[model samples]
Target: MTPPPMITDRDRDVIERYADGATLQEIADGINLTRERVRQIVRKHGGADAETSRAARQAAKEAGEQRAQIEFLAEYEAIASNLAHQGFTRAETVSRISVLYPSIDVDVADEALRASNIVFDQNNDTDVFSNVALEAGVWFLLGSELRLKPDYAWAAVNLPQELLDELGTHLSEASVTPDELATVLGIIGAAQNAAMSDPTLTITGARYNELRSELLDAIGLKSATGTKPWPPTRQTLQKRYQGWSDALEAMGLATASLGRPKGLLAFSEDDYANAVIDFISAAAAAGAEPTFAFYGEWVKEQAADGTRRPSPASVRNFYDGWLPALRKANAVVAARSAEANLSVE
Candidate 1:
């Protein structure tokens, strides 16, 4: 039998490639050797550092994929942004991209569209970009300094056909993100609801903050500490609108007062009594003491139900003292329990 070829630098190269995940045939084709000859060389090297070579090869593959993704995003941004500015929806833009670039997958096109920041209605098939732009105009006119202009103010409230035509043409071109559109619209809704019960066309910044918190509670969006909320923060709104007053104006509302009204003024005497009774009853059910501290924490928790409970201080103020309030609440709870037991018997 003929002996295998003696180990050479070329053969060493073959061994290295094999260790780096090249097949025997692939190494042979590169080095002008037979597949069997390359395999013998790799075997003689005892597959030294093969695992390390494999890990390095995987790292290289990942790096290549990341590079590809970066290129894809850059290209997609150019195409999608232009389409969005021209009034194309995400679905429309994505469809066009898939046809224009047959190599790109539809899913890849969808991902690129989302990252492009080209606003599209994620909630429905509706044209969110156009809708938001038009709605924003209404609020913008309502809030803008232009509202002081006689012609514009009449148009702002009346929204006549000519005003609608102008707003539709102008505002439909504004660039706005989905989150911003949702938040501004949500604030508008909350303001309208608040206005129904009050005799004011404007609300305080403090009241606005409270209403927003209640909005989040009603919508089931959790607000984490140090993180942005669904409707975003007041600071974010200010940045977007150029100022808090401007933002309120854009929501078609004005600033009524500067600070929060003290003592949960929205609640009445019966509401306060009912809240105390509920707290003591809940504590009794859980076999826990209805301490003032616990009641404060409980009130915070109850906010999730969209019921604005009094602060611990407000509760004290309402009853004239903490211990006296607790005693009264406890008595009410006890009497209710007794009545329930009698009814059951």
Candidate 2:
């Protein structure tokens, strides 16, 4: 009753193979049937198959185990770029993701992290420090830059619960209190700022453990066995962060945002400049001082053909970067016009 033999040809082939002294396992392998099913078929065809030779069975068992191991490994990949983009080591991104997605086993995450080291070596990348000294050195400099005490006396902040929730602070981490949450958030900002100041300082070790150990050591924030101060684990950082966006938001710093930042226009830089100047000139011609709202309306109308390309934040940046240049140009034009009039007179 092996699902009602739908193919007579396949059944005949199995019977012939069994009659030719093939072992049940060999026939099953070739015909894609379970060995017991093959054995039953062989018994039905007038002669019983021989017992599996012990040595062959052992080999089959090893082969099956090897196959399983190979398949299990396929559950994760060890690519370097994959790890860097995830920032697995510094942020405990893997652990957090595992918490978020229950099926992602920790072993798989570890394998992926280790694989990144191999990939990093193969790719000849130096984004991560080659030695603990360098990583520690970087951490000391970064912590100093932010003026954070290894003990969080002068530099701690306290956010309300709503902001804490928005920052993704889970209850599990010791960051339950506001000062605790602020201390870690401060560290994250400090790290980001340090990376900005020196691109090499970007966290790049293949795993969070390496980063955690290095940073804690450098800052003398020992965990579990030191006299000075205990440091936050990578897990703690993850409890309050979804990445730079949330980190910045939590700290009340400027941000690009989860979606597109407000006020980025599709206009080319030159077009954007012209629109700003035109908006200002039009406002002046109307005997009204140019303002951010007027410029926003100009951007809205110019980009209205299909989309509002420039976000408000980006427009604010444009105003910040180019308005002074426009003012300078206007001043120069006025000076040249005055000189020409004097010469003509």
Candidate 3:
């Protein structure tokens, strides 16, 4: 037979806390017991385990969601029927419902209505619904007070009149695409961030690439889904404008340097140079010469040890060419060696 659990005061405290809705971890933290020990004490005292409590909560949440969705559906059907009786098309009904009840998930309503097998008047008002929803969405997102104002946040409270008018024109049309909206917002965001510090700042293709992440973060365009669209990629921008240079020209920005763009910009030119010089030094210590072929493997090794090294391409771009990079790294290595020898002397 198993020995009964010791009925200590701490055990009683754990049981009482668990009964009062304190989680095992919480009880354990208060009475200085391991979570597992607290869990055992609670179970021995006829209380539910953490897993059981979690499952119950999850089940309740799912049931509540189902109930709410059912209620929404019932209301949606009644309103939709009333609208149809008034000779409104399904699209018009959807648009009116979206405007009147901004809290409702219009897409969910649309899907539920479409699945209900109810036929209504047919018209080209689908685009009418699309236009209304798109216009609302653009303003809701861009005008949201909750949007983050990172270092690169735009100083202007509102977009330029020309861009605003262009967006308005797009929404006024019978058709609109998320891609079109994304492109407009992307260009405007990029230009604003570029001019944040200097109004006359020029955004060349390379500079644009360097600031891409910061621009996207400032504009809150991190992830894209099927219904949601993100800022256009570099390839998309280039394709849209016929070439990188043409794109920069369209934006009225110019490149100051002809050198290829470096990665991440978090790493400086010296950071890249130092990485190559360090590699050359380590290779010499191992009786080898650092070459382009071995640099990639060396980077991988550094990564394995949790040290980040700049990409080989970034290093080459920083120094202009492979030979020039080697010569610079060798020169640095020689200077360091000479300094070390002088110190020793």
Best by TM-score: 1
Candidate 3 lDDT by residue in tens digits, 118-194: 44444532322232232222223332322423222231232334544545454334244555454445444544343
Candidate 1 local lDDT, residue 229: 33
Query: Taking the candidates one at a time, how many backbone clashes does each contain?
Result: 1, 16, 0
> How do the residues 192-268 of candidate 2 rate in per-residue lDDT, one tens digit apiece?
33332232233322244354455444543321211112223332333335453343333223346542332535666
Model 1: residue 261 alpha-carbon error in angstroms: 49
Candidate 2 lDDT at 131 equals 22
Q: TM-score for all predictions?
A: 0.33, 0.27, 0.23
The TM-score ranking, best first, is 1, 2, 3
What candidate 1 gets wrong by more than 4 Å, as runs, is: 1-6, 28-37, 46-50, 82-92, 101-345
lDDT of each: 0.54, 0.45, 0.54
How does candidate 1 score on lDDT? 0.54
Candidate 3 overall lDDT versus native: 0.54
**Candidate 1, residue 236: how far the Cα is off, in Å:** 24
2 or 3, greater by TM-score: 2
**Candidate 1 RMSD computed on C-alpha atoms after optimal superposition onto the true structure:** 20.5
